[model samples]
Target chain A: MQQTLEQKPPVSPKVSAPPMAPTFSIPEPAQMPVSADYKTVGVPLVENAKFAMRDVNVFYGEKQAVFNVNLDIGENEVIAMIGPSGCGKSTFLRCLNRMNDTIDICRVTGSIQLDGEEIYASKMDVVPLRARVGMVFQKPNPFPKSIYENVAYGPKIHGLASRRVDLDEIVETSLRRAGLWEEVKDRLDAPGTGLSGGQQQRLCIARTIAVSPEVILMDEPCSALDPIATAKIEELIAELSQNYTIAIVTHSMQQAARVSHRTAYFHLGKLIEVNDTQKVFTTPDHALTEAYITGRFG
Target chain B: MESSVLLPVLALLCALAFVAGRSRSLAVAGVGGMRILNSLPFYYGSLTAFWCALPSLAVVLIWSIFDGVIIENMVHALVPPAAVEAAGGNIGLVMNQVRNLAAGHLSADSVEPAIAAAADRLVALERINRWALTGVALSFALIGAILAWLKINPQLRARAKVEDIFRWTLLACASLAILTTIGIVMSVLFESMRFFSKVPVTEFLFGLEWSPQTAIRADQQGSSGSFGAVPLFAGTLLIAGIALLVAVPTGLMVAIYLTEYASPRMRNLIKPVLEILAGIPTVVYGFFAALTVAPVIRDMGVNLGLDEWLTISSESALAAGLVMGVMIIPFVSSLSDDVITAVPRSLKDGALGLGSTRSEVVKLVVIPAALPGIVGSVLLAASRAIGETMIVVMAAGLAANLTANPFDSVTTVTVQIVTLLVGDQEFESAKTLAAFALGLVLFVVTLGLNYFALYIVRKYREQYE
Candidate 1:
């Protein structure tokens, strides 16, 4: 690659690079302890990492989107995926839940396992898999429905509650988990669209939580929100990490630093590096990861 | 021939003035000077043509209005006062005879010698009047041309003046449409008021007994023509109700299939074919209803053991309403397809991402978001059904029976209005005037439906935005 670059005529100084190094030491995996701070006790430890992705590659027709990406999502832990635009972080995140199957031209290969069972196996049903791995989108898109009905929709469809009290309890618990019960409990009959953007986003989160998924995937969940709303969502994500494995794709470096325990950096369709959040930010092994974190290149 | 010659002379002068003005400006600042002007050279040309044509056209219009009256007065003065009085209200008849006599054709009726001489005198007077009008029109054109030439200067602000004229012209075009609607309403109101004067307003509006025959003599008539509009109104509502029942669900389902399930190739193929149903003239629909659908309905009625009173006919409301529903399916489906497709894709993705199936997302999110627009489309289609004439005229019978049964023969307001005004009839009679009354009622109903639909659509838009 270095000889090829030296032979080609350079158009601009920005295109030039030093010769590729022959030997560089790949860092050993670090064992970081989970934080002890929490509002509640007796939360279960993330066991054997709930979801494990290995060498996943995604293609949209002939154009490759995600290339040889690997990720391990621990149960009850928040892992944030951060990258610049078109970096395939979202593509890799979508592959874990089989959401990419919804797109007509997208073809995802390689293995994604949930609890050591292959999720992408031909015999596995996609609907139940989706129920186990729910998603929240970038913008707040609450159903044009009443608040009570929006939260109760999934529970009703899955037959999660047999009696009226059970259904009510499910709605209340989900809303409480999302930290929206206090603001919306009095007017549960009001249309969900009538709420503020942040409240609507929380309502959507509660709606997803009502299904009792094992993992929650958020795709830039705070991108469309104001600072205060983003803060509220970050606090909710911290709370949710105690019960569900969470994978968040975000553009804000500071947000990833604040919310995630494990950080994965992607560049140009490749997972350049993944490490403990503090180490990834303070001392990255890969030159691309260092440049991305230090704001030198994206 | 002289007026045609004068018009072109005025046109030529205007064209010359435009070239002169443009060239003079170009000469002042060299060849590229036109780019400096605010408007193009053609605006200046049209401006010159407008000024030249306007005042002369106004004078010509005024002359044409008064010319006939002035000539008739002069001819009348030529005759003696006693003779003119004797001609009396037969003056128009006498004038026609005089014109024939002046052309050397003998009158069909016997002509008195005095009338023949008076006709001869009128021919001389017409010849003199024609010469005077031509001379006056020419002088008016000449004066207008001179004034336009003087005003066509470099600093005349011709572009601004032309734009103002165009602005007023557009306003006049717009007002013409508004004024025409007002004129139609006033005409309907006047005729309806006349019918009401003959038959009391309360009886015409709400009376149960609707026989409208006024006895010409002590013993002149059979059954009287009824003026009670309740039967027709009820028939219209029943038919429209049946149409809505068939169209609303079917159209919405078709819209969902097209927007949500069908591939792009299927959508492109099916949408135009469905819309073609709307373009197939209502008369053709009427024929299908009367010839095809009605017989099938009658056979079905027989199989159901319906009595003679309830037996369907070749001209039954059921057939017409069903075909009309089919005719209006495109109206509902196309509108709904647009509204459904207009729903943000993000909303669909958000629902689907939460582990919801395609059907679930459609039912819970897409349909609710598009509900108001769908309601608006249905209401508009309902208005179309109520106002339809040709379909009901050919398929639905002329018997104005007040019944909810679709199999029974019925007459709607549009059908009755068509039957009342088919051939030559005295417009002054209550029978003819009743058509206007029916038309007025139909207009009011459809207008109200349209306004309500617009209101719903606007309100829903406010909610989402």
Candidate 2:
């Protein structure tokens, strides 16, 4: 058994080297640790994965938007999906909660199971499904209503609280979780649209969390925000992963590296590679993944 | 004939002077002289033309107005004062008859020799006045031409002078429209004041009865016509209310369907058809209401077992109001549709992306966003309903019943005003003067509605932007 382990071939060779460069000897798998509990397989705080997408495919009318893709969103863990523009990362994210159903021409297929139950079943109620899987859009889309009402909209629709006091508690808790309570505690009656972009995005997050969703899907939530706001949101995401499963779609690879425990690399609608964030950045299995990690190509 | 010949000669001379002055300036400084000038060549030509025509036209206009009065007064002076008194201020009528007779259209009977001799003198006076006017006009034209020619030096800056005059002319034209509006308002106010003096202002305003007849003869008894305007106003409101009740919902629904639901091809096809309803002449609608809709409504009421008094009339207010509503539907729908469509598409997307259903989005967001513009359209339609005359005139009854029942015959202020001044009538009577009072009230009401609508629209805009 020791001789067989010593003779095993390397799983990933460094493909980022130039074609004309001198060849280096491939390291044997024996040199790497074989511990049963590796850091790359560190268990998430929540035992069950929240969502498991298997070979998901999406089409927009005649054009294919997302090709066969597979990803796993572990419970109470942050997973970031990052890719170049038009790489179908956002499309893949929208498929998680069936948000793409709002688009008339969009058609999504392949099995996406939440907590081991199929989400796209014909009999399922999309509204309640959306409540369970809340989303924050690229641009902050607070209802053109009062700030308090914007935070209360989802709870009101879902009947999340029975009494006014309970509703207030839910609102306060959600705002607190979104880290927006203190800044907006005074002007709850003002219009939500009057807030800055970052505040509005946070307000949307508070609105989404108000319903006590099991998972939060964020699609470039900080793209329209300033650096300070982006930093705040990144820290919030890190904290949020302790309680809720978070799947963030971002164009910024550094943002993925900074915030996520696991990073999934997508290219041209395909999942090129997904592994532990540090390992995915420092070493990747696929040539496309290696090129993308080193900025050789998208 | 000789004066006509002289007038043309004088006009030709003026035209020649203008051409000569313009050419001389251009010739003095070669071909590029006009380009170097401050203004275009047309300005110089117009300046010369203006100088030539203005004084002459003013003289002619003034002379024409006063010449008739001067000649009539001269003729009256020649007639014996006793004869003028005996004619009982019928002298003007008699003079007209005598002049007709002199022109060889035979009068019914021979006039008195004094009147005939006066008429002949009047003709001679008119001829003399005409000759004097022609001479004055020619002399003025000549003076204007000479002055324009003398002022045509390059240093004179003919363009600037012309532009100055042109600017004043434009201002005067603009003021003409404003003055006309003011004059109309003043006339209405004056006559309304006279009516108020005859009938106390309080009685006219608040009296429940609205009869306006007075006994024509002393022998006739108990023929006092009530001047209370309450019945007419009530009739107007009742009809307009019915119109709005029918129009607002239908128009708004049509607008929503066109803007939100219908496909582009369907909208293009249906919008023109609806607009055709607006283009149909109100008189056509009037006849259709009077001839077709009223009878149908009457039969329907009878079939429904209505009492005779409650039965619809051949000229019921309902028919008029319904037709008027149809007439104004395009006005409301088209305007509202344009405003609704003008709402930014991003607003719709935002609502939809929130997972709200399409109907919910439209009901909760789109309509509220477009409420101000919709209100403006509705107010405009209301004003149109109030001001509509032909439909009310033909379909609505003449009696100004104060009842709110649309099936009953009723009259509006516009119809009453039309009847008051339609045929051979004395303009100074209280009946004729009442038309102005009604007109004033109508104008005030419509103006108030317009201003309120505009205010609502402006306020809504401030909130969003």
Candidate 3:
């Protein structure tokens, strides 16, 4: 049996070679570890917590997408998850508001708590839970309505306001908070879809803020915008972070560094590192994180 | 040659042209290298084949369409003027007899000597005409083949020319449907004009009664038919309204269930079964409405303890309307399902992420986004209901009562048209021509409905990323 094991025709001969190559190899993806467990190489915990996720695993059908992601989101802080495309950053971010429940065949395990309550509990009604945790998508998706109606949609549905005057006030306040009140103040009756791309995104942000959610999740909100629009959104995010605890998933490391208080690095569905945004950029503890930031390879 | 033999012969020549064209191009390219050729060899082959077939086939088509008319005219000329004078200038009857004689279907003893002589001349003319057709068509094929073979060279833009011909062919096919529609509309317009010429336009448009009887003779009494179409219009509206009332809500809810609530497996099982309702022939639904639903409704009214004031007929607009609504449900539901599913998942996510329940998300977001498409579907179903004849004919009696009550029997425009046109009648009579006028009105109403529906869809179409 030992001789046969030794004589097994050198299966996967390329895997035994040295792992470093100066030139980028796009066709053959870099070999990643296949262990059942993942390692946390740097700071992956936080002190003052609004959302604490521990040992969480997500599966789509029979394939595991996220493995044992343990991270914490602090109150009034923006935590940005950055990695290459399909690195499970968006999947982990969606886990906070139970967004993955909408997808059939997606199974999530382990604990994810929001304000010390298990959000994934079967008894939990996602209606109020989602009201508390609003989200902005990668592309702007404003409701097909007037600008005022778009901002008023969330408040009207959740019964956040009773009188017309109060609903108007909420819409105004949400728009003001999203920093879109100045430009769109005169044309409240125009269709929201008629706005520019950046304005449409800000309109979506205002719509989310109208519901008064505690934590706002953004999934690559500025990736679809021009540089000037991205700058405006980044500035708006910075101001909004003072009031709401934010979790942002982005492909741009520079955007994450500019807007987030803490940055988390994900590689092959594992939580590689988490630290202050400045420290992660200056001195990343893991080689993969360093390699990604330096543009050596993803 | 006969048509069967000529077609195969032309096809054989075209095949030979294709081979010759390809080989010529290959030989020309042998010294200059294949790169000098303008297009691939297959395109040259196709160009030659198209050239060989198109002109020769056109000749055959023209000959086939006009040969009988031309030959009949020639044969008619051969029948002497004395024979025509004998038939009292009924040249059509005389020609029929001459044709029968030429075919030997008419016995020689029963015909006149002039007709027999004309029949022999007719036979000879037909035989000569066939030979001339075969000769002219073969020469045209030979000329076309030679021209195409002469034009085959490395410099020819064979691919582009072939593509242009293909584009024209596709355009012709597409225009066939439009031209046919134009033809139908023009025919209806001409006949309706004939109808309006006899009956005043004002009387037809605004008349309050619809008894369409006409006096056969000048002395006939109580046979002057009233041509008021108001009752038919009212009946159509009433039945269509009832159908809309029943179909819209049921279809919308079923669409919502299929798109939002039901699991994938349940959806797959239920969707096709719902569509099977659409596949059922309207005639089947007609009898079912007439035989089953009409009596059931009458019995239900009887069981309701109402007095003799409200009498339920065996055939009611209610019966026809209800089954038409059932028939149209699959139309509404299937179209609505497609548009509702077309509402981007991102919008649903946006609503759900705002903490709204599933019902709230669908009502507030998905429905609003899909409303324009849903209205279009409803209009389509409405036109179908308005145009439906079999159900109304079998279920509703043909009484032109201009009443608003659903329990009374009524007649719709479609039913009136079917009844008027079902049996053989003289086309010159106003009674027969009234069918064309009713058809024109029905066509215009449905056309207006479709235009309005399209306007709504265009004005409110939503954009989503």
Candidate 4:
């Protein structure tokens, strides 16, 4: 066992100790409390906020999906939302770009501001708002077009490129930024769907960045990929956070700790804790966050 | 015994075998317990019923099929050779007369002596045949029931045997549809070959004239019945082209509206009402085309005062094409609607998240993703339009003109087929056989269209996770 531990490359120096500790200290399911209240406002305010969401609530028809949640996404910083499945993390992430408006039954009641301007204002058109805030889905959804066309789709639609050469440059630069240019530059005419899952996801990221959005929202972008592919995307995310504000929803606590600057923990549609990634993973302020990160129950 | 009684007696034995087998299993199980039985009791009962019923039913079927032919041959043998020779190989007519006399529907005074004697023999032969069938069928049923009852034991593997039989029965049912399709193709091919023997294949395919009016009497003037089918093919294309032009845009727009824009309540209400257009019988559409649309078009043409230069016949190709388009709207809209709805919500969200408006999302993402299915729907509508007959028959008169103009009278392949085959026409004439030729060509065209549609759909299908 000692030889095996030395043979494996470490993910992090801090995360290795918790699993090595005795398992008996973990609480039994029967003895644990049935429910725990969450903090409603977990470190909500940031000094250089790119997006400030205060008291957000989301509903799907008669069912409330996300309870009141207040959070701030800082400029050029990666904020990762981590939770169990169906904990409303993805719903909260969608609120950043108002993507939930596409769903007929979904209703939002809160003030979501981008650059101190209210997004839900009566006259605010969603077109330019969405151009400013792009998204990547959990499963890669590239348009059924050529790789070049997929990357150029956004810039073409928003008229970001005035000429064919300009469109070509934007496509090349976006794919390069997403770390897919060298592999796909020769076959730009190939359909986007023909690429591997990892490449397809990168193509989606490239498409989002073609319009040069100020904020990029990603929902489990690497959950559908292999481990090698996941590492590549994680690397891409680390590089991308330098130029754009990123908010990602993930089930992997380790991924949050590795990639994001600020990590937010959600449980049962409520925000439980928000802090720096290392601080939250090493010494969580809330018991629920600790239980989740330690793999007690989802 | 009569066959009607024989059938019921065999069924009764089968039922008895079922009860006997079930009780026998229970009794055998009693030696240990119910768990000792290899299968459930019901399977054993059904297995016994099948064993008893199947062989006996086969015997009955074979006997019934052969009985009529064997009796007819014996009756033919009874008729004196010279008298049968005098009938000039028209034995079928002679059999009909003899059958009428034996049934006592014909007066005895009208028939010849040889025929009357043969009729008596026919009656005797039929009775003997029935008696023989009854004896053989009953004996088979008895043997089967006794054997199956004796075979029923704990180690019989009755469930496995029954399941094997069930599998074979399902295979048999599935092959029945394939076999029927093959049978139709072969019959049409033979008839078409017969037609080609009379009219040269090149002329039938390439010749432009399509006047298929062969004189019934040799003395009748004009109409030597040209077998050229180019005009019919042209007419079919013209009418179908007009129909596709009308249907494609309208159907696609309606689909987009229903799937993308309409409220759920509005969609639920409008979708079925549109589909009701499909449920309206083709004959009803024909009547609507003939009585309403054709007259309206004519009135409009007259009001425009273009009647002097070009007469818009009440039965214009435009009228039938328009009505057929309306008829197939549900076909296109329903299929396209389903495909559009199937485009993943995530793709639409991805586009909307890029600041694309609803219409932009539809055009760039949803429609392109759904393109293969949308094209498939259009091809299906085109096939339906090409094969449409009743509306074309009533509204577009059966005058196979080789012209592309929509306002002129025209006829489709199906309409010409109907007119050529209807009423009193001799089967041996080239005119009647030409119908089969036209049908073969129509089938080929539609088959080619379907294949092309499938090829396009397969080549470009976008598989989403």
lDDT tens readout by residue for model 4, A124-234 = 888999999999999998987899988988998899989899999999999999999999999999888889999999999999999999999999999999989999999
Kindly indicate the candidate among 3 and 4 with the higher lDDT.
3
What is candidate 2's CAPRI-style docking category based on DockQ? incorrect
* lDDT digits (tens) for residues B109-207 of candidate 3: 799988887888888888887787777887787788778778878899999999999999999999999999999999999999999999988899899
- What local lDDT does model 2 show for residue B37? 63
For residue A241, model 3's alpha carbon misses the true position, in angstroms, by: 1.9
Off by over 4 Å in 4: A1-42, B85-89, B462-465
For each candidate, give the TM-score of chain B: 0.86, 0.90, 0.94, 0.96
If chain B of candidate 1 is superposed on the true chain B, what is its TM-score?
0.86
Q: Candidate 4 residues B1-465, lDDT tens each?
A: 686798788888889889988888888888686788898888888887888888888987887788788888888887776666677868877888899999999987898898999998988887888888888877777787778778777888989999999999999999999999899888889999999999999999999998888887889976598988888888888889888888898999999999999999999999989979889999999999999999898888879887877757878998999999888889999999999999988788878878898899889988988999999999999999999999999999988788876778888899989998899989999999999999999888899999999999987763422
Off by over 4 Å in 2: A1-144, A157-163, A170-180, A196-298, B1-83, B90-177, B306-314, B458-465
Put down candidate 2 lDDT per residue, B170-274, tens digits, no spaces. 999999999999999999999999988877888877888766655567678757767778888898888888888889999999999988888778999999999
lDDT of 4 at B355: 87
TM-score of 1: 0.84
Error in Å for residue B161 of model 3 = 2.7
Could you tell me how far off, in angstroms, the CA of residue B346 lies in candidate 3 after the best superposition?
A: 1.6
